[model samples]
Target chain A: MSTLFSGQLLFAALVVGSIYVLIALGLNLVFGTMRLLDAAHGDIVMLGAYTSFWLFTLSGMSPLLSMLVAGALSAGFGAAIYYGLFRRLLANTQLSQRLEGNSLLLFFGISIILQNVAALCFDTTPRAYTYLDGIIRFGNVAMTGNRIAVLIIAAVLCAAAFLFLRFHIYGLAIKALIQHRQAAAVVGVNIERIQLLSFAIGFGLAGLAGSLLSMTEQITPFMGFPFTVAGFVTVILGGLGNLTRGMAAGMFLGFVEIYGVALTSPSLHSVLIYGVFIVVLFLQSQGLLGRRPS
Target chain B: MQPVPIRTSLIFVAVIGAASFLPQFGSEYVVAVALSFAMWVALAQSWTVLCGMTGYGSFGHAAFYGMGAYVQVLTWGTLSPWLSVPLAGLVSCLFALAAGYPALKVRGPYFVMLTFGLAEFLKFSIIGIEATLGQFSRLIIGAPSPNALYLAMLGLAAAATLITYVVSNSRFGYGLRAIREEEQAAETIGIPVARYKLTAFGLSAFIPGMVGAVMAMRLSYFEPSQAFDALISFNIVVMAMIGGSDDARGPLLGALFLIGLSELLWARAPQVYMIVLGALLVFFVLFAPQGLAKQLFGGARRRAT
Candidate 1:
């Protein structure tokens, strides 16, 4: 493992991690502030893929337009979930501790629905957009132009979201809410509005990631569940609700995953990733960069 | 179980007796249907014991099921079919032992995510193993006769039901229920929260493992996607949830209902089945999160009588 930490692997990790970052930050925002786990997040990414694929398939539109369209659509879906499912749960739930538990069921249901519907519409076979077929080389290493595009898009979006949380008026409120919801409320933050905003932003980012994913990977209705699970792992690695840390952790995980895939037999790739996840969990349950104990 | 009224006991006996003897009277199709229903009952019951009762929600229980199937397929060439169940159960129990401590250290969504991740990890590891061995070719095994398989599944289901019945009525069940209601308070009041949770999780994984192995034998093959699918966990979770998890009978009823519904959809409109399942799940989560049993039968509150 130590010997594998060369620049190439590190660079590969960065690219892979950036791909992960496209969706994880959104999950982090919702998980961190609202404590809602939105397990359907990966499905949103899958939808983004479809959005791009369909845009190309039907209208011959550019992937960039598809990205924006996907982002908007997913944000709408996220808002719908918040208003239709989450808002009801939040209002009905008496105990703060049990909210996420109850909400998880809703998200699970949503994920199922999303998968089945997408399957019905698109079928289960993987769908990939016919684009970004070029590669860029540096030194002795070569990477796909699609991978670079995904990396740049993911980083830029992550930075934009991080900045929003840092400097935007609503961003400060969200930050305050994540740090201390009760205090944030006392300080006159509109908690519900901000929560909805965060939720929408998270979904929007997921959608964006999905569009970017069209250029890099296969898409399927069922692809979301695994990514959602991995996203959760990323969230835990960076500490729950710690958005920026999630970025770093996402990269770290990408490195681990890429290197794990590289070092082990093809089948053992997932094993190595999971093995690392469990080990890290046992060593520091709080995550490498998380502030609060999950 | 409390000393039941003779009528209720008689009803129970009659129902199970009819089910156990179902293969004798029906075609192989009936046997197959019964087998699937029974498997769901067993899997859902095993899952509900820890997740439903404890409220920890083991979202990835299918991992145990998949692992059990994997273990069975790997070792079944030498071992007897009956023996594989216990072996798989033991292996899955051990995995729960290893994962539970680290996983249960967190609560709420984190716990759910950890369980989900563990299952995903198992799924990937299986895929990795398959890739390494280049064993994409299907396993060719002497599958049990449909009748024998049906009977075996019925037995497993009965065992699962019995386990849930006993556990739900026992002191251990009470402690688990306490944990579900409020863990920190339960710990403060001396519930041995961690120990109880681990025990619950281990117990939950065992029957599913057994059921998974049985499924492998029944299916006569073990593919990574089909065997270790995370969707199985989702189905079991949905079943446990929709039927309600507050009572021993919840999972049984839920599994029967969903499996029956699935069979119907599978027969008439296989494509629409998942769409319907998704719709039902959303409906249940939003409108009936207490599950149908809780809403219809007045579950735990009514159980006291």
Candidate 2:
């Protein structure tokens, strides 16, 4: 009701939205370019959280230090998955008719594997790290330092990624692949390596987001799928593989969730998110900022 | 390919028939597992009917299953579950018909996302309703009767399979296949693309809706989290694909193998069972992406006819 609470809500949305964008950006890269609907992307995010959680607890590393470890771990896993699993799938384009179903099922399988593995390894306990304990107040408004840090990190990474994709040579290659994979291949763009890099980077970003999440929420093995839904929604709402659009949508979803849950009641948040999610899928399949793949 | 051998059809019928009479020869536990197998078959086959034939992989076909279960929960104290079961299917039918319009428009890979989104929307809606009420009050239709539930599920499964068999062998089936292969081409060739997809979607929804209702009756209690569990979607999609979505027999065998294995292994270590299943799904996708029926009987036997 109060303007101060709304300011607080706006701040919460920015912080949460920033993390959501970070989580989904990697998904947009891999999904937009490679065209694999990596259902396990969310699990990768969860694994990233686990990686940092274990490091912070056992090794007594700071949050910032553990974020790099999580990123590396997830990137390695992504590259390994590409070579061990996805590489074979991409090779089997001969069966053409079954290609789409096969890739989807494969990712779903990976999701199942990762979820159970995390459950076994981490024991399904919801965990959080207390690196930043106090709130930063502005006038009548206050926001947690953890959230502020997450926002800064997420925003900076998103901007850097935006520039990297728009101007960098590898980013150009990724864009070429997204626009016309066959043409890109014919032009000798080294499709495999670029795809591998993109997959690793995408997963690394997801892990980074997960690392950020561990500072704020209770991390759990079960958390990945919903986050998968979140990441998927953000990526789609942002227009398949458009990272900037995904970021914008993530920010939008965060506000709906924060205000919808905090204002009226907490239980309505899922409905609000999913309702908006489905409606958006119907209303703007092309995404808020995306032009059709054509 | 040589008049399409009748032998496979006969064998398919025999499997369904034997399953129908399973309760007579098997123990209570066997009956229970058999019913579970039947439910999976129906779920997988219905999914196969819409997605497999049309080339759209639905990541959240569990929407119908949850709808059926919730329908029972809503009507528990008033109507008999047996009566509510068919209505559950009707509700699912309406939902699919309503959703299929917008959902079917989601081109290419996004189809999976759209379906998944819709299912999640339903799930959250249920949860929202529960939260607003602040409790998951039990809504029992009657006494918990496993035997009747098993028989009912068997019938629904049998019906689902029969419907699939009919669809696969019919002109409509051919239309669905054409759409799967190339929607634009099918549209150009004068197939009513919308009608075919919608009908297939409706067909797929009917049986699972009923099965979900029966599952709720068996559970004796209902909660949004439990009834609309995302695993229902995951398991059905995994089994269908791993078993071979291209044909009915393939997924039937797949659903049986998986449902049976989980029954055996899940008794002690549920996590281990899931891990093994996940590994198999990945292995199957990588190595043997072909359906078992095609592996055994051979693929798309058109032979350029």
Candidate 3:
């Protein structure tokens, strides 16, 4: 039991939690802004991983560099999806419930398209690459250099995203839109532009997370769904659209999952995570940090 | 919800009666195709009972189906499938009854996520249980013949459609539609919102459970992962959406259309079938939000809002 709370487990929890936060950040952005749940968000993550994979396999470019490339490419894709698909859906405000319902189905369709396309283009077999595969030890706990890199880079990116959303003018505009879409539009916040920007950024973060994930794990066309589930769980836990709270919840989920698995069995990790998700949902449908309706 | 016309009801009976003869005269391939058609129709129509009626949009019918499959597999040999298949439906109904309280608490996207999460939770829990038991997969020996299974599935399909048809016309179904149109308003008007939703949820889960059991028996194999495949849930939603979930006839049209399309494409290139299906979902939502049955057969034009 003592070993369950060891520094090794704690470090592992943080590393895994960082990935959850990375993916959830994008989900939070899109859901917060558009009130649309992008079910294909994880597919974007898979695309980014594949992009980084091919970049490395073809040109030997470092994943660190390709991570940015993946982000840019995913952002472009996100913008295209918003423009071509979701724009009209968002135009009408009267069908708010229908909007969420339509978008959910729409994204479900997009996810199917993305998964099949990837499978056809790149066969269903798993792919992997070796980068920074060295050992790093801090006293009694030893970690892979790639994992440590994932930690540092994930932390830096998360902090940068947080600061941008907190302090930037565009960030404020996005927040305003999230808080009150009509009011924000009336106050001169360009609804279309902010929606597109946040959509792109949300997708970009997913791509970035995918690239980082490629450093530590095998990549497959089907890998994105689990991450998508994790991202959704985190966003739900923090209350839908609550970014900072989502991030914290992601980390909290990580600890629970890792420690829970450590105490039980590795195969039960999903059970633990989803058990927590269902419980949180039933107990606090408003989300862990969300205020109760008076 | 309009009343079903006698002529349409007669036509449905004639079509199903004709279909029941396929196993005796149709080739093996034809029987297989018919079986798949019946399975989807059963699954999709049941889904329409809850999700389409209430606008809850559950992404977890796979859980019910999977639960049914698991139950069938566990009870194989010990119990006759005659008893087991309906037992599967009973178990799934009870599961729905248990899960409905928390599940129905949230609306729209939250409902989608919670249902999805619940399915995943069940899937992983089953996987874990299988691992602990050191059984990665289970196989059914001496499973029923395809003809028997096909007949069973066809009955389930007819039953599901009948239930949907009945619900659409009944006061119970009106309550469901009322909830869908405006839950708060419906409750204000003295509709038993909670009870209606729970009953609809449970009712919807029952047929899919039987479908899953029959499908597992047909395959003669059961693995937790395959049984609980999320794609089953996705395909159910897509079929419901494409066929239009508002009426019994919509799911029938949808099941046939998609099954026909899949038969043509999946034989040559499965990837193309998937891509087309996804594109079809987007196209239908954007252009034909009312679905094929509604457009073809003519029904209440979708309330624009």
Top TM-score prediction, candidate number: 3
Q: Fraction of true inter-chain Cα contacts (below 8 Å) kept per model?
A: 0.52, 0.66, 0.70
Instruction: State the lDDT of candidate 1 residue by residue for B205-250, as single tens digits.
Output: 8988888888888888889778877778778877876787566678
Candidate topping DockQ? 3
Model 1 residue B189 distance off true place after TM-score fit, in angstroms: 3.5
Worst 10 residues of 2 chain A by lDDT: A93-102
lDDT of 3 by residue, A1-294 (tens): 789757899899999999999999999899899888788999999999999999999999999999999999999999999999888788755444487778877888899899999999999999999999888889888899988988999999999998988899999998888788889989999988999999999999999999998988898888998888788778777887778888899998888888888888877777887887778777566444575211
Give the per-residue lDDT digits (tens) of candidate 1, residues A218-284: 8878777667866877887777788778888888788778887878655566667667666655545
lDDT for each candidate structure:
0.79, 0.80, 0.88
lDDT per residue (tens digit) for residues B151-206 in model 2:
88888887888787778888898888898878899999999999999999998899
- For candidate 1, give the lDDT: 0.79
What's the DockQ of model 3? Answer: 0.63
Candidates in descending DockQ order: 3, 2, 1
Candidate achieving higher lDDT, 1 or 2: 2
Task: Give the CAPRI class of candidate 1.
Answer: acceptable
Per-residue lDDT, model 2, residue A263, is 70
Model 1: lDDT of residue A175: 85
lDDT of 3 at B165: 87
